[model samples]
Target: MPRARLHDVAEWTADGHRYRAELSAYLPRPALATGGPVLGTDVDLPSSWWADLREALAATAAVATTRTTVRQQWIDRHFTRLLGIPAPAIAWTTGHGDLHFANLTGPPLVICDWEGWGRIPVGFDAGLLHAYSLLRAGTAARIRRELAHVLDTPTGRAGELVALAQLLQVTARGGHPDLAPHLARHAERLTAMPVP
Candidate 1:
């Protein structure tokens, strides 16, 4: 829906912000997953798929952290409030809101579950996808390639922040033991990044 609405606007004016704000208002909040579902139980996607997913997450993170009213401190506060746990000292960005492998389908694979979609950091989706991809090995290069392609595009850079932010938010909230170790690693990677 965010993409669809974004595409609907042809002119660049203050109205665009109004439209985006309206879209954010209309969008529903995401439901808490009781237990994080199996990350890649449904999809037979290749490891290379993580590249595109990572790019998208990063793009979103960049937009949210840099462009939105929300700041990293605010994001941490909200995350702590929402998850009932002290927020990890990590950067935040806009998120896909609810990103899981199941949200993706079809050839060229479209992502669904836009309830959590909003401003985030560049690595949000990348971290989530990386955590999920941990069960497999030798696919990181492919994922990196796709991300490089995205970073080369204008929107790609913008979306990167949002994606990373979302990735951090979701992993913190989801509470999957299976993912804990992977999350820790990705979180470390995110924390090490030089703020863009």
Candidate 2:
């Protein structure tokens, strides 16, 4: 898959602030058609677009990643809030690691930002995508429907539990405050586990 080509990277500090920058070739396409930034958007993607994404994900599955973006102990620790007994046993596979709307483009369906790409629990990519769609109920539902094969299993649900736990951890560190309650509610629904 053709992507924005990286040319150079440099880091420097100025007075009291530190900065890092990288230059990469630009894509002719706009960023994801989904609104912008971290905002939720109800993007109405076509079936063809979904098919392309599935194909791309299948390709992603073929590659192996040494990077373990999140350690098991950290995941299990936070997962206690959701599953109450750590993440359930689940399959594992290569994934984009960050499969949210911001990393995905529409029309041509080009995925960007590969730095976080790595091995994750099976269904983790779909689970992370669904997690990001929570604010937009319709988009979230569409993701579930499109990836039911992955999101509708015990193992798949475990993968989602981990993903939600990670999101909640991010929320704790000050992010997406509006998403906290929703994430908690969904976590309870998934595991019926008591939150501490």
Candidate 3:
């Protein structure tokens, strides 16, 4: 499911020379799963799941550290730099910015929540989905496959970097109880991978 457009309007102000386009809001439908066992909310994810997540994280890190125009710099002058890569050119599409098991339900597994929807690089949503699936063992490959299928189109490939960017944001915000462990482990692995 993609993010729904709430409002879009263009405005002219000042002496008529200044113009602005404002896209108000967008979001997915409400969740049907409710309070029963939220997926991806566990801190101690399976090791196999971690392995698969590490692979994806490594790939994303490669792209982020290599291709981005914004270089990672320390908040204060530190001994390390956070490298950032540019998003690859691709067709833009509305997507459920946040996709997790908690947000899915029923037969088709409809995704909800559109607050994060916007123009992004390929595979952004799929990557997050794959990471969420990593909470359990034996699901990584399946999740990865599903992600690949969802993002296999040319437009998806071009937007892969956008997905990577979103992942990086999640990783950096280590306060989330559900994602803290995954992000910590991912950071370790990312630091270990050889920079291209």
Candidate 4:
């Protein structure tokens, strides 16, 4: 998988302000989406792209990381209220944490934006991509189909709900209003109960 390589980082105090800059290798391929993280329309991608994505995520999950993206306490505190169900025990794995369309590229799959990469619920990345694709039926279906191995298990379902709960919390803050209804509907399907 291709990715922008971080080369160096510098931080310094200039006058009364602090500044930081990072130098990274430029990636030539454009991201799969722009303007926002969610995909509003169906995108046409070849089967190979899907295969590559699956492989990439699998490889990422196999890595070990001490950084945490979704903590158990957060899930315990918010999951019941946000999901209308008790939080389940989650298995953890390394993931891209922010695996939406805007952070990925094609032709040859390249995952960008590594700042958020860390330990997360086992299916967090796949669930997040699936949630972002909810507005586009074709894309959503394709995600579910292509990532069924990870998205259709007990821990995976818990991870998906955790992902949806995170997005729903974001919606509460007036971000991605377009995704709220779809997310709520999907949450209902997952929990078999209306979200609070």
Give each model's whole-structure lDDT. 0.45, 0.77, 0.43, 0.89
Model 1: lowest-lDDT 10 consecutive positions? 24-33
Model 2, C-alpha of 4: deviation from truth (Å):
3.8
Superposition TM-score, candidate 1 onto the true structure: 0.45
Q: Candidate 4 has what TM-score?
A: 0.92
Instruction: Choose the strongest candidate by lDDT.
Output: 4
Model 2: residues >4 Å from true position, as ranges?
2-24, 33-39
**Candidate 1: misplaced stretches above 4 Å?**
1-71, 74-95, 138-141, 149-174, 189-196
> Per-residue CA lDDT of candidate 1, range 1-196, in tens?
2232332323334844632222322224232122343353334445554545555555555553334433566655454343333444443456665554445543344555554466544344543454455544434434445556544344443333343444446656764556555545543453453222
User: 1-196 in candidate 4: lDDT tens per residue?
Assistant: 4577889989899889978777888888778888889996787889998898888888888888798988889899999989888898899999989998899888778888887788999888899999998999999999999999999999898898899999999998999999999999999998899989
The superposed Cα distance between candidate 4 and the true structure at residue 70, in angstroms, equals 1.1
- Candidate 3 yields a Cα-based lDDT of 0.43
The global Cα lDDT (0 to 1) of model 2 is 0.77
Give per-model TM-scores. Answer: 0.45, 0.83, 0.45, 0.92
Model 3 CA lDDT for position 6: 43
Using lDDT as the measure, what is the rank order of every candidate, best first? 4, 2, 1, 3
